[model samples]
Every structure is written in C-alpha cells, then in structure tokens.
Target: MRGTEPPVTPDGRYIVVRGRLWRKANPALDAEARQTLVADLMKARRAVRDAVRIRDDMSLRQARRSVNDAKVALGERGPVWWTDGAPDLNRRLARNTIYAEWYAALPEQP
Candidate 1:
C-alpha cells in the first residue's frame, strides 16, 4: 500500500488493492476524527494479532469487534457514506464492478 501508488476511484469512494475494491474512509470526516479512527483501527488490529498469537478466543473476538467498530466509524464499512445510493463494490474484483472501465485504463494494476 506504500511502495506503489494505490489507484483510487475518481469518486474517491474506494481504492483498488490487489485488483479488489476496498472502501475509502469518508471524505466528510474531519482530519482529527479520521486520524483518531485510524489510530483505533491500528490498535485493534495489533490486539487481534496478539490475541491470535496467545490463542485467546475471547480476546480475538473482542479485538475483531473493536476493529469492525473502528472501521465502521471511519466509514470504511457498514452503511455507504455517500448519498447517491450506489451499491457497495467492496471486496469485489475491480475488473468485475462498475470501476472496470476505469481500472482497465490504468497504466498498471494488480
């Protein structure tokens, strides 16, 4: 996600990663809010890793839930943040969704 520039849709709704679409955080969110959510998401992800390493089912579940909550709050999951009613293409292959034409035009893709 760092070495090469990830291609984000023109609408700014999703970023293509490994040929799959992942929802972007809500652009409407203020910088501080977005930063805080991102921080929480990272912490939760670390917790998930630790739980898995320790073989703690309860902690794993809690960590996963926290991660989900942070993602939703960041507008990366749950309800669509946009008002246009476009169906979510998250986790879908870029070649199979409405972004196919755009993705095909890219100079490089996964």
Candidate 2:
C-alpha cells in the first residue's frame, strides 16, 4: 500500500513523483465529507488486514471493494481532477510510464 500521505506538488494540486504529475484529491471536498471518507477507508483497510489474517477469500474480496469505493469517494480514484487531460496514474508503477527514466534517476523518497 502507498503511504496515506503522498508527496504533493509545490502548487498542492498534484502529487509529484520523479517529476511526474498525478492529480491530487478533490479540493472541493468539505472537511466533514473528507473525514467520513477517510474513516471509511481506514475501516476497510482494517477489514482487509483482518481478512488476510483469517485467510477468508470472500471477506478479502469484499474488503478490497470497500477500499476501492472509499478511495473513489475520496477522489483518489476515478476521473482526473485537473482539466489538462493528464492520464490518471494513481497506483501505477513508474516504470510503466513515459517518465520511467526520470523516475529511475531520482533518489527514493526519504
């Protein structure tokens, strides 16, 4: 899993990894909504962990869906937040994109 707090671009609108851009969470999300979604996300994550420990495949599948739903609600998935038409690269491996060289050259985040 990626860190809960990913590094944001200097402008705070995008996540910056190896100089590549990924749209950040929706700024339009109000505080209460954000909190609720985050809580749901955490709950789902805990469910996933529990399911894994118990080796319950059905529970794991359901928990994974919940996690994805929460992420979508939180604007971490789905449509691009920016109007520039940049491809959504959330959860993508750096080596798969055009910025692979740049990503490889940059030092790992501390």
Best by TM-score: 1
| TM-score result, candidate 2 | 0.69
Error of 2 at 54 (Å): 0.2
> Can you write out model 2's per-residue Cα lDDT over 6-71, one digit (the tens) per residue?
555444555655445565668889999999999999999999999999999999999999998988
lDDT of each: 0.94, 0.75
What TM-score do all the candidates reach, one by one?
0.96, 0.69
Inter-residue clash pairs, candidate 2:
none
lDDT of 1 by residue, 3-60 (tens): 8879999899999888899999999999999999999999999999999999999999
Q: Which candidate has the top score in lDDT?
A: 1
lDDT for 41 (candidate 2): 96
Backbone clash pairs for candidate 1 read none
RMSD (Cα, Å) of model 2:
4.2
